[model samples]
Target: MSKLQEVFKNKSGNVLNVYCTAGYPHLESTLQIIDTLQKNGADIIELGMPYSDPLADGPVIQQSSLVALENGMTIATLFSQLKNLPSSTGDKEAAIILMGYMNPVLQYGFEKFCKDAAEVGVSGLILPDLPEYEYETEYGAIIKKCGLDFIFLVTPETSEERVRRLDLLSSGFLYAVSSSSTTGNEKDFNAVEKYLERLKSLNLKNPILVGFGIKDKETFNTACKYANGAIIGTAYIKALEGAANVEQATKKFLAGILK
Candidate 1:
C-alpha cells in the first residue's frame, strides 16, 4: 500500500487531514507551517505549489499565492525549503502531499520533480486541472513508477462511473471537493452529504478526504463524521495573515479544529 493509503487507514480510525499552501504568507513560513501542522495533529499535509494563474482557487488562496510568488517562491526554492522538514517534524509520520497545477511541474521537469519530491518526503500529489483520461493515457504510469500517488479529485458533478474508474486508478485517498466551486466558498453540507453517501455506497478501494470550505471545528467535525478527514486551507491562510508568528498562527488555527 502507498504511504498515503496507510495514513488514511489510521485516519479512518480517527484523525483530520489538513492542507496548507507552501510559501504562502512568506517563503520560509512553508517549513514552519508543515512542522506546526504535524506537531499539532494534522494527519496528512497538502503543500500547495503557488502558481501564477490559479483558476480553481478563491480570492483568499489566489491572493496568498500572489504574495507568495512576489516573495520569490518557486519550485526549486520550495524544494530547498522542504529539505529542513524531516528534522523539523521530529517523529511525526504525516503523509505529505504536494498540490499544484501541471504547468509548474512541467517547468520543473516531471522526472526531476517526482524524484526530488520522493527524496523530500512527498508521498502523493493533487493536480486539479489534470484530466483523468490524459493522466491515464500519459502521466499515470510514470508517476506510479516513481512511487508517487497521483490523488484524484471528484466534485459534486463527477459521475459514478468516473468515480469507480478514479477509485481504481487512485493509489491513495480520494479528494472530495465539498462543493462545486473554488476554495473559501461556503461548504454546502447538503451537497457534501449526498456526495459522501454516494462515495460510501460505491465502496471504492480508497478512503476520501473532503476539502474546500472546511474552515473550523464544526465543518471539520461534519466532514470527518461523513468521510475519513477534512482538508482546510483558506481559513488557515487568513489566520496566518493576522498572526505574529507562523507557529502561533498554526496553533490558533488548529485550536478551532479541537474546539
Candidate 2:
C-alpha cells in the first residue's frame, strides 16, 4: 500500500492534517516545518506549492503564497529541496501530500512532477482545479503509475452522485469543504451539521477530512464527529504570520486543536 493508504488504514480517528506553504516564513524553512510538524501531532502534511493565483485559498493563504513566491519558491525549487531532505524528515510513517495548482505542475511536466514527487517520498497530491473527468482520462493513470494518491475535494453544493464519483477517484482521503466558499472563512458547525451528517450517510469508500473554517479545538472536534479528521491551513498560516519561532507557533497552534 502507498504511505498515505497506510496512514488511513492504521489511524482511524481525529487525524489532524496540517497544511504549510513551502518556502514560507523563509525560503529554507520547508523541511524544518515538515520535521517539526511530524515531531508534533500532525498526522498528515499537505505541503502547499506557491502559486501566482490560488483561487480556492483565502486572503491569509494567498498572502502566504505571495511571500513564498517572493522567497523564490518554484515547483523546481520545491522538488530540489524535497529531494535533499534528510531521511529523518521523510519518515516512512508520515504521509506528505503536495497541494498546488495544475499550472505549475503542467509547467514542470505532469509526468515528471509525479516521478519527482515519488522519488522524494511524497505520498499524494491535492490539485484543487484538476477536474474529475480530465484526471480520469488524462492524468489519473500517470499519477497512479507513479504510486501517488490524488485526493479530490467536495463542497456542500456538490451533488451526491458527484461526491461518490469523487470518492472513488480519490485515493488518500476526500477533502470535504465545509461550505461552498474559499478557505479561512468563519464557520458555525452547528449550521452545517446536517450537511456533514448527510456525507456520513453516504458511506464513501475513502475517509472524509473536513476543511475550510476549521480553526480550533471546538471546530476540529465537531469536524471529527462527522468525518475521519480535519484540515487546518489558513488558521495555521495566521499563527505563523509574524511569529519569531515557527516551531513554537506550530506546537502551540496544534496543541490547541489536538489537546
Candidate 3:
C-alpha cells in the first residue's frame, strides 16, 4: 500500500493534515517544517508548491506563495531538498502530499514531476485546478503509474452525482471545501453542518477531509464529527508569519487544533 493509504488505514479519525508552504519563512525550512509537524501532531503534511497565481488560496496562502517564490523555491529545488531528506527518522513520520497548481507541474514535465515526487517519499498530489475529466483522460494513469495518490476537492455546491464521481476518482481522501469561497474564509460551523451532513450521507469510498475555515480545536472537532479529519492551511500560515520559531509555532498551532 502507498504511504498515504497506510496512514488512513491505521488512523481512523481526527487525522490532522497541516499545510505548509515550501521555502516559506526562509529558504531551506522545508524539511525542518515537515519534521517538526510530524513530531508535533500532524498526521499528514500538505506541502504547497509556490505558484505565481493560486486561485483557490486566500490572501494568507497567496502571500506565503509569494514569499516562497521570493525565497527562490522552485520545483527543481523542492525535489532536490525532498530527495536529500533522511531515509529513516524514528517513527514520527507524516505522509507528505504536494499541493499546488497544474501549470508548474506542466512546466516541470508532468511525468518527471510524478516520478521525482515518488522517489522522494511524496505520497500524493493535490492540484486544485486539475479537473476530474482531464485528470482521468490525461494524467490519471501517469499519477497512478508513479504510485501517487491524487486527491480531489468537493464544495457545497457540488452535485451528489459529481461528488460520488470525484470520490471514485480520488485516492487517500476527498477534500471538502467548507464554502464556495476560497480558503481562509471565516467559518460558521452551524451553517456548514448541513453541508457536512449531506456529504456524510453519500458514504463515499474515500474518507472525507474538510478544509477551509477550520482554525481551532472547536472547528476541528466539529469537522471531524462529520468527516475523517480536517485540514488547516491559512490559519497555520498566519501562525508561521512572524513566529520566532517555526517549530514552536507549529507545535502550538497543532495543539490548538487537536486539543
Top model by TM-score, which number?
3
Q: What tens digits encode model 2's per-residue C-alpha lDDT throughout 117-175? A: 99998999999999988998999999999999999999989999999999999998999
Q: Looking at model 2, which ten-residue stretch has the lowest summed lDDT?
A: 85-94
True-structure RMSD for candidate 2: 1.4
Off by over 4 Å in 2: 89-93
* Deviation in Å, model 3, residue 247 alpha carbon: 1.2
Clashing pairs in 2: none
Deviation from native of the Cα of residue 72 in model 1, angstroms? 0.6
lDDT per model, in order? Answer: 0.83, 0.91, 0.92
Candidate that scores best on lDDT: 3
Q: Write the per-residue lDDT of candidate 3 for residues 1-259, one digit (tens) a residue.
A: 8888888999989999999999998889998898889988888999999999999889999999999999999999999999988876886789999999999999999999999999999999999999988998999999999999999999999999999999999999999999988989895768999999999999889988999999889999999999999999999999999889988988888878776
TM-score of each: 0.95, 0.97, 0.98
